[model samples]
Target: MYTDALRAEWTKLRTSPGALWSVVALAVAIAGLSALAVAPVTCPCATDTTKLTLTGVQLGQAVAAVVAVMLLGGEYGTRMITVTLAALPSRTSMLAAKATLVGGLVAVAGTVGVGGAWVAGQAALGDELGAGAVWRPLVGSVLYLVLIALFGLGVAAITRNSAAAVGVVLGLLYVAPLVTAMVQDDDWQERLQRFGPADAGLAVQATINLDDLAISPWRGLGVLALWTLSALLLGGVLLHRRDA
Candidate 1:
């Protein structure tokens, strides 16, 4: 039954024009922005200039989140969710299948986005970084996109409204950066940057100024992962209890 449910959702995603377009748009937006950010500046003093150049994850994440939210919310908007639940009968399996599909889709798209971003970043630097330094940002950026997709899935599950889901995901992604800017105290600003998902997650790409960083790069990405997982769990619980 679960297997069939998974197959069903996979079929749905594969046939959907929106799903295909979303993946394509996500790759282009993330990779293009990353390239633009990295192309003009060479962080000569930084050993891990790869990370600095690939800083477009800050903006690309919002695009991925929007895609993820639309995946589920589109069904709700079209009144297909009720039919989906009818076919599966178990809301748990339905949601699980959706999440698994969303994760897999994001993982594939993320690889493309991250790889493209890395090449752009490297070319922009006009210097070949050590393999070890280069791969971290490349890999971390992929993980970042996956987490953003998961975060969007969670938000959609919670809201079941496309407009609301988009709003919530965008707000979560963009608002923190703005609020961090508004803080009057330097210390608080730094703290917010260290703790905030965007600032913390981007830390994984940092290859320079380690001592001056509020949070280590990999650890910052971990913080974003934690946020993603927490939201998913909350959405899962709500999904289990909801009437559908």
Candidate 2:
């Protein structure tokens, strides 16, 4: 049942009218902003230039969220979800299939876009960086993108509205951290930094000051994984209960 659903979802996603274009948009958004950030940097300085170039992840994630939202949300919009539900029967299988496909596709596109940014970062430095230095940021950024995509898929499953899902995803990504920043209490700030998805998740890019970071790099990624899993579970439960 799961394999069949996976195949069916793959076929549907591949034939979606906007699928190819959306993937292209994601890559371009990341690569374009990253290249722009890399262009002006005078590297080999006493700062984390890798993180600076990775600023594109901030803007590029919006596109990733939209692509994922549109995957299931488009079905809902067209009332094609009814057909999908009927064909699959098990909602869990259906959602899992979609999530797996979305993760795979996003990972590839993210790597291409991030690879360009990394190369630009290398050239800017006028010296080659060890794999140790480059691997963390590069791998973390790609994983971050994948989680963003899955997070969008989960939210879309719950909301079932493309615009509303997109709005909610973007709000949590961009606004939660903004609201956290307004809190003046140091302890509260640290707590928020550890919890907010964007705040905690982006910590994976930090290489310069590991000890001084509010949350360690891997722990921050764990915080994001928690957020992503919660959304997926809630969406899955609601899906199992609600009528399609």
Candidate 3:
């Protein structure tokens, strides 16, 4: 049953023109922008260099999240969600299937985006790309995009409106950092970086300065994962409890 549902979800995604174009746009934008961002500078620490090179992930994630949110949000806008729920007859199972499909596709596309970014950064920045310390940043970047997509899915499930869902997801992912920048004290800024979702999550891509890093690489990724999973669980609860 799960496999059948998965196939059905896949069919829906492929038939949607937005899905393919969004994936292509995401891959190109991330790779191209990251290469440009790191082209001019070299860092003493490899981690810093890697971080600069992967900066595009910070932007690309929002795009992936938007795409993910649209998967469900579009359905709701057109009142197709009711048809979907009726056809599947198990709302929870249908949502699970949708989430799995969206997550898997986003991960694959994100891999391309991040991989292209890493390679382009290496070529454009040379030593600035950070030698052997590349893998974590590369893998972490892909995971970051995937997580953003999942986060979006959860937001869309709860909100059920394309515009509002997109707004909520983007606000959660982007606004916190902007607000954190307004903090006056150095201590407060560092504390926020250590705890904030975006700052803490990006720590996974750090390949150079471990001692100075605000959080451990694994822990940083875990923080983002925690945020993503919590949102998903919350969305699932709302999805099961609310009307289609």
Best-fitting candidate, scored by TM-score: 2
lDDT of 1 by residue, 36-111 (tens): 8766674565456666556666667777787788778888899888889889887768777877887777778777
Candidate 1 backbone collisions, by pair: 200-220, 203-217, 204-217
What TM-score does prediction 3 earn?
0.92
Clash pairs (backbone) in predicted model 3: 47-208
TM-score for all models, in order of appearance? 0.90, 0.95, 0.92
In TM-score terms, candidate 2 sits at: 0.95
Please write out the lDDT profile of model 3 over residues 175-219, one tens digit for every residue.
Answer: 987887898997898888777778888888887668787788878
Give the C-alpha lDDT of model 2.
0.86
CA lDDT of each prediction against the hidden true structure: 0.78, 0.86, 0.81
Where does candidate 2 stray beyond 4 Å?
128-132
Worst 10 residues of 1 by lDDT: 125-134
Candidate 2 local lDDT, residue 22: 85
Q: Write the per-residue lDDT of candidate 2 for residues 139-212, one digit (tens) a residue.
A: 99999999999999999999989999999999989998899999999999999999888899999998776888
Please list the residue runs of candidate 1 whose C-alpha ends up more than 4 Å from where it truly belongs after superposition.
42-48, 128-132
RMSD of each predicted structure: 2.2, 1.6, 2.0
